[model samples]
Target: MGVVRAAGAQAAARLTARACRIAGRGATSLPGKVLLRLDPAAIGDLARRLPDGSIVISATNGKTTTAAMTAAILEADGRSAVHNRSGANMAGGIATTLLDARGDIGLLEVDEFWLDGVAAALKPRVTVLGNLFRDQLDRYGELEAIAQRWRVLAQSTVGQLVLNADDPAIAALGRGASSPIYFGVDDSRIGLDAAPHASDATHCGTCGTPFVYERRYLGHLGIYRCDVCATRRPAPSVVAQEVQLDGVSGSRFELVIDRTASIVELPLPGLYNVYNALGAAAAAHALGISMSTIVVGLEAVRPAFGRGESVAIAGRALKILLVKNPAGANEVLRTLSLEGGPLDLLAVLNDQIADGRDVSWIWDADFEGLAPTIGHATCAGTRAAEMALRLKYAGVAPSRITVCEDLPAALGAALDAGMGPLYAMPTYTAMLELRRELVRRGAAGDSFA
Candidate 1:
């Protein structure tokens, strides 16, 4: 009877998925939502089917790219993993991934807010807790709240843990795990002069006192310590050292696992990506993957969608960097400042449900870094005027900022009236809309599962 019920639920899910596609809607999460409606136990049941079990990755930023990198490494090691590659990372998304899974192990990027529930369901063999930043305040609340919840989840989980030693919030989760593998960037050359205004990790988790930044990088992620409590950043076993960032091209760094060093030429730009690679390598190391395979796979991994994805349009290249919150946007701006020539930008701001309806988060992003190098900028999406205003206050010349509520018009204008490399910075839903527009114009190929 249990087998018959499970088979019936799977059939219903497939039928719903087909219907969604035929109705001009993408078959991403609707099928899973339908399946869960039919069988609440579907995610756990499907996750259990994998012979080698599953792995879960959760973070405010970089989880998608990190998961992709981990999957590439595992695949190179001849272990196939069922991955949630579409970037739909909620419960419905997890269910969809598991329902269509065909691999030895499951590799899932669980949304930070949904991690507890999904972890409860899958009970994965390894749980990778990446950095947590202040994102979607309208939805996820304060960073401390999310950290408190994760601390509980970490304590309850029986799986092996992989954590980012650079992020204080993530590193604190290690206390709950029996044994945790830690990863971070060890190069001081990439450290920031000071923490940005938008930095979230201001206070210590242990003492509630302010943390003294020894070295800050990409917001509050860096070497720090609580002077009062003496709590400091964890020393990571797997670290990236001697890092070099090539604007819009890629990066080069040494991957050090337990003092064993190997040069890794990753094809993704920014110090943020270095963190992603480190997190992926650490997770793979916990699963017994060789360091050689980790290096080879990382060097071959491409940008996941709008996270530095390049799209060519009419003899010029348009680089898309997805920026939804303050910390991630700060990294993109910092990376852009490193480029040689002036930048032409189409910055899109949206207030959709997926992008957090409260658009005040844009004010928190540090756009001041790019003001020096910005050639011409166009703003688009539901809140284009707000973004243009942000640039104006960031010291960009009024003549350099253009506001177009429509994405296509903004993208076209930025390309037509600008010089040098073009950069598109869009919120999550805006990225989807822009991609659809690019596909329509035959500028980008149709995305597949």
Candidate 2:
């Protein structure tokens, strides 16, 4: 049975590679969909080929970034990992990633809904659980429902659960386990004292009463202690301290892992990513990566495409952010607000097959908070005018907003719109479109091959 499965997987990978070549597309999740046509267990088949088992990272946000961090730590420690870095969270994405790797360990970023089935099949050596907030309400339903699903899945996985202790939703999970480790940030300098409007996870997962927070980082992620019955954020087996953000590009922090001390620099940005770095660091330590090797690998890492990724754009630097849902979009806005100066924004909206067919999530995003600070705004994509209208209602001065239905034209107009730095926030498919346009205009690197 195993021999037959290996042969089948080999054939599938070859066929998918051929399709990608012929279609002139960068490696895509569509290949996985192709494999499913042959066998639904195609991802599992691919995973079995990896010798050192795997680690599965899943959440509504930060899966790709977190998985990339773990893979970097592994490679630094001399173990290679097959990963899905293109935001393909389905079974097919998993299949394609595994088939591409020549490594023993598989590091995968999976969708929240796919967790139960994928976890059962891969039987990973470790799993990392980041916080869960309401994202894509139409598709994901509610935060409570998704957390319930994770709890059910955790009950079955035999490996260790590296959970985000600050998230009450995740803190409530993996309770039966005696060996799970938690990783969270403890730097008071970077902590949020009171919960913001975006904050969730206030109630005790154990007691249902509102929990007290010792600190609040973006969106209910921070140190917390329950007063009613003593439920609280677990002290991390690994914790990040003295965090220092180096703009939207990178950060440095001291990681206390299993009692050893090491300073690490991450190639990604945002306070959210600090938690991601800690998760990766803790999980790597559990997997036996030396602190020195982990440090080397993390510093060598680069941002995954469209997630705080910066590229040389026609002699100037442009940062790309994929803003698909509300919670994430709001955080990006908050991050930008800290700049304390005029900012340029390019917001692209598309109601396409890959981007959620519904674009209403834009309203839920706190665009109003982004208005006063937006010195120049250029809206693009097929729904550019729609986005402009939305921004106008959000208090953006109409005079400062420009709508360019043509992507190339919009990007150029946006780049020239404002005086300060440009922030491009596009939806899932719109981001792809913008990338293609950048390629056409000789604005982006041809590293796709």
Candidate 3:
């Protein structure tokens, strides 16, 4: 590390400590508006100081869960893996996390928008490219824009490029690489019968021709063939197939790595997570770990916060999913096909800064189909009335919807509405409020329980 950069990192560590003390919360990513008080070279220089090189994981969705899964795999194999588990995905977050770790295998979860900046600062040893979907249309112009950035940085990266074969946006990222390692689901039973409302990849990235789908796993992902010229889902080196999602029962699938195969069952539900497991397993294999350790680590790891996140409440488990954008929220709602009868729902909508200034994307979500199964719903947040109105339009009876401005009251009403399990879907900031409410209501004991 350069002298100036080393000094900057030390300064950042000290400053991070000061900020934590001032805020009374643990050190976290600086607010975007907060003055960035460090040398830009400090992050890159510190990465060199670590024994194990950096691993950068980027995606529109699944980045957090994939980061957790990869870190758990590394930790289970007895490697010290450092990560930003607090959902901090910017330059300061990466810098502060690296500063705190001093030296460890850094599994950095970075935002798609900040990939270039973070990559220029921290030249990662391995980069995992998960599928890209249309999300936060205002912040990110389009899925193609993020892919373009990845395309540029992939040339400069010194380590393995772990790409997703199912996502053509991610698949095209490996165009110039020397057979970059790929991982995806090869199962037929676990995908959509045809394209659903949320599928994005219709036109080929390489050519402008419309891509034909042989099968679709989730949204915009599946084995596809380009009709015009040459563009399709890349064949992954490590693939998962014969996948079976048993809803509440969990998912069991087979993994093929280095030509060896094994059956593994993840306690987490949904098909998207099957892809998450594949991404983590592929990264683990690239890290040179055995299949056994990968299997155990994956099986042992639990879900991430608000991404198919579950909590035990009132003697029943409540699944809390963060429905921030259209594609992600649609996928979560689509997973409802696995649910049986009517389900209790708690939806919180807010225009908080963290939760995007615009909440209009709720209309794009497939809430109409999901509304029928919703037995009772408590709508809360700054936009609680808006959400209640939305549910009403989606065929939900006005009497079935409860609008409570306060989170705790809304949560209580939602919980009391049904003896069946509850599903809390909220925007980003609203999820935090629900978590706080969960703690305050003694739903979870003290201390973020």
Model 3, span 60-156: residue lDDT tens: 8889999989988898899987788877888878876777575468889999888888887778888888878887776777777877888898788
| Model 1 Cα lDDT, one tens digit per residue, 1-449 | 28899889889999988898899787878888888888889999999999988989989999999998998898889998989899879999889889977999999999999999999989999998888888988988888888988999999853989898888888888875787888888877888886788787678988899988888877888888999988888899999999999977889999999999999999999998999999889888888888999998898898897788898896779898999788888888888888854788899999998899998887888888788788889999999999999999999998989999999888888889866679999999999999989999999877654
The top-ranked prediction according to lDDT is 1
Sum up the clashes in candidate 2. 1
Candidate 3, residue 295: how far the Cα is off, in Å: 0.5
Per-model TM-score, in order, reads: 0.98, 0.92, 0.93
Model 3 root mean square deviation, Cα atoms: 2.4
Stretches of candidate 1 exceeding 4 Å from the true structure: none
lDDT of 2 by residue, 1-449 (tens): 46686577568767877878798876666667766666677677778888988899987778878888887888778787777766778777787777667887888888988888888878888898887877666677777888888888888863778888777788778578767888878788987655555556778877788877778777778777889898877777788888887766677888888778888877777777888887788778778878888788778777877788776675557789888777678777767776654788889988885666777777777777778888888998878888999999999999999999887899888877655568899988888888878777777766354
| Residue runs of model 3 more than 4 Å from their true location after superposition | 1-5, 31-36, 445-449
Ranking by TM-score: 1, 3, 2
Q: Count clashing residue pairs per candidate.
A: 0, 1, 0
Ranking of predictions according to lDDT: 1, 3, 2
The candidate 2 region of ten consecutive residues with least summed lDDT is: 192-201
